[model samples]
Target: MTRSHRYRSLLLAVSIAVPAALGTAQAADTVKLGLVAELSGAGAPAGTNWRDGAKLAVAEVNAAGGILGKKVEMPEYDTQTDPQVSRALVQKAIDEGVIAIIGTVYSGSTMVNMLVAKQNSIPQFVGSEAPAIVEKGNPFVYRTSSGAQKGVPALTPYFKDTLKAKKVGVAWVNNEFGKGGRNVFIAEMKKAGIDVVVDAASEQAQTDYAADVAKIKSANPDAVFVYMNQEESARFLIEAKKQALPMPLVGEVTLTEAKVIELAGNAADGAIAHVGVTATATEVPGIAAFAKSFEDTFKRKPTHDAIKGYVGVWATKYVTDKVGKVDGEAFAKTMHGLCLKAADHPKILLDTCWDDRGEMSRPSFMVQVKGGSPVVIGTVPAN
Candidate 1:
């Protein structure tokens, strides 16, 4: 070959190789996180809040210098409230090379999609409250809030000591989240010597609660436990008001959320719940600041789901920084038996801990809706 031809060939190789290496370096300089959520359909209220809260955390993390000196990039994937769709989106997120995932607030969807993250060795932070989400022993999966196994049992004392009721009615959505909570609540009720006189199961996105209300009213229980998603909880509350059931309405998680209160209006008043996290706990300076920032950015009140997403992302950053790099297996290892004190990490917003199975433990709240807002009536310490 001629000298000029040899030189041209060498130049071509250098031109191709240099940009390829730079591209690889550029990609490595940013931490990519997958945000999979039910951003549409039935779970939009919770999912959108979660997504927005995570986005807010991402913004703050970048502003304060991102994890391990790499900028954080989160790409969102909408699940459309379908379990199968959530699974697909999770797989897509993994394929796109996200080191960690924050996701589907719906427990049903999480149950189906979390496997994708597990198989990929990516740590996932979920907003799901289903006990089964963490019970299956997937070390890569973690909860942003306590599961039903913990949150529901916290209400047992309320029923036995505070409400002092012998008979209660249970109304729950027939999804993974609702069923897990219902089963735990039923067991707790039984242990408290309370009888479940009426058990009503509704579907996801169920619009009618007339028959459910009638059945509860006929059973004449002293109080009724409502375990459903946000929109469904509002619909049921409105129906209960229409029927004037005359029993104290109580719930966990969704019942007293801002979305439920806004949707149920006056019907949300007088309802009480045990919430794992609440944006209305203004007494906590960190939470108060988070709520204010969320409201300012989104132009709406933040829900517990929002708090979950916010803390989930901050927790991701906190743990990732502790790991000192973007290694999924290392991140998952660090999460088990991990505890973050709010005094040390203000972004975590609470003193939180996780067990070996990735279930979370934190101080929770018992809230009552009054004057169109959820008022924190009591605090439940972590067990």
Candidate 2:
């Protein structure tokens, strides 16, 4: 070949290679995190709040400067509240090059998808409170709130001392979240020498709770412990109100969430719960500011799931900064036994600690529905 032809061929190779390298560098200049959650289907209330809260935190993070001096990019994938779909989405997020994962708020979905994160050695922050999520020994998986094992036992005192009940009924959705909470509750009741007069299991997204409430009513327990997702909890409360079941209705977590109260309306009144987190705890300056900001942005009150998501992202940032890099393995290693003080990292919004198992510990609340709203009746110290 001629010299000019050879020179042109070399120029073409350089032109192609330079842009490819530049593209790779550009991509590497930003940090991508996946927000995978149940944005639709039965878990929408919790998932949407989670997504919005993460988005809010991401915005603030970017405004202040991003993790490790790289811009933060969050790509969202809707899980549709299906466990298998959530598992697939987690894999997809990792395949797409996300440094970390935030999502699958439904415990069943989290249980299925968290393995994907573990396999990839990607740190995942979840809003799921199922004790089994941490029990699996996945170092990559972490909770934004306390698990049922920790939160439900706090209710034992309320049931045995406050209610003074010898008999209680249990109504739980048969998902991982419900099952874990239900199991812990039953054990606690047994320890307290309280009898479970009725134990009813409902399905996810079960609209009609007439039968479940009927069984609880027939048992005539002193109180009914309602352990279900937000929508199902609302439906159960409405049905219980309609049947005029005279026993007190109590629950943990989902029962007193903003979305549940909104859906159940007056039916939610007189309901009580032990919540790992609540937006109504305005006594905390950080939470009050977060709730107001969330309300202003979303035009609705934030739920406990929202706070979970917000803190999850901020905790990601806090720990990432502590590690001084975005390495997923390092992030996971740093998270175990790490404690974040709100005084140091205001975005975390609370003083929080994590065990080696990635379970979270923070102050919680005992809430009651009054005047169609949740009011914090007491505080539960961190476990």
Candidate 3:
């Protein structure tokens, strides 16, 4: 965000903060919800969408006369897209005595604060897709989106059964997001009896990826899966195009941001990306109405992070309703027991009406660049 935009957002946040405080003050039987996420930085695009989406929902819910008998009030924290900072914000939200807390968007960020949430017995709903995130099996914390394990297995079938690529190469940034993506993709590929040509590692902080691309080109794989965030993705795409690498490039959800389009320019044309089809609330009727309201209020499309942040709040609302209070034990009872399904929910990718311990049953699809816009190729599923 530019200096001017940051100031504007800060102003907007301050404005929202004042009303939230007043609203909380007026609460007799109202629910106080806190949304914590990176409201600024590179993650801001997605983060703000979540902040605004949750805000939109709270507004509507309050207009309809709140949950659990009183009006709903949301006090938000901007984690600035850093895991360390998100940890602090979690404690801050807890100290503020919020009934339930709604955010902490990224897998890495969510991972940082999971302990705080567990210790406090706070009900936290996250939108992170990293498999290791919930591996701790903290019953107090719930994810709305399927973990990377569940989401990426579908990509293997697309490669082996649909595209029929005999040999695939991987160029992934080394991190929870990238590492989990590769592990899941590799496991599925092996199960399908596919061969791996090049398994190269790339750093998310690197400025140039010419070396990685050259290595992949030398291996001459049929297709390449790039697991990287938008920043590294742009650099790789531009450099890959310049080097004229011919392999089809498939990507993880990290590349599905508007930042990729902005940074990669036309180089983004052929990069295929896999994302949760319904992470944002676009599919929700009430969420759709909230979306329009968000655009009217915030002047932008709610990115997946925004949807995730919004999901945290909405998830709390659902659980709180079931528990009839904001206690942690009660919330856990609802999360593990309540079969919440919202196709229109901001976190529908994590929403599983019927879930088990193995993997999620929701559909994950592969999308390709068509005429400069992304279009679904087919549903990528677990085989």
How high is each candidate's TM-score? 0.96, 0.96, 0.82
Tens digits of per-residue lDDT for model 3, 312-347: 566666657667865788667656645655554433
lDDT of 1 by residue, 206-291 (tens): 99899999999999999999999999999999999999989899999899999999999999999999998898999999999999
Model 3: residues with Cα > 4 Å off, grouped in runs: 1-29, 278-294, 342-351, 354-361, 380-383
Model 2: what TM-score? 0.96
**Leading candidate by lDDT:** 1
Supply every candidate's count of residue pairs whose N, Cα or C atoms clash at under 3 angstroms.
0, 0, 8
Local accuracy of candidate 2 as per-residue lDDT tens digits, 1-383: 89999999999999999999998998888888899999999989999999999999998889889887878999999999899999999999999999889987999899899989999999999999889999998999999999999999999999999999999999999989999999999999998899999999999889898898888999999998999999899999999989998988899988988899998999999999999889999999999999999999999999999999999888888889889977878988899999889898988888899999999999899999999999999999998
Model 1: how far residue 146 lies from native, Å? 0.3
Screening candidate 2 with a backbone cut-off below 3 angstroms (N, C-alpha, C), the clashing residue pairs are: none
Overall local distance difference test of candidate 1:
0.93
**C-alpha root-mean-square deviation, candidate 1:** 1.8
Instruction: Please identify model 2 stretches exceeding 4 Å from their true place.
Output: 1-15
- In candidate 1, position 213 carries an lDDT of 95
Higher lDDT: candidate 1 or 3? 1
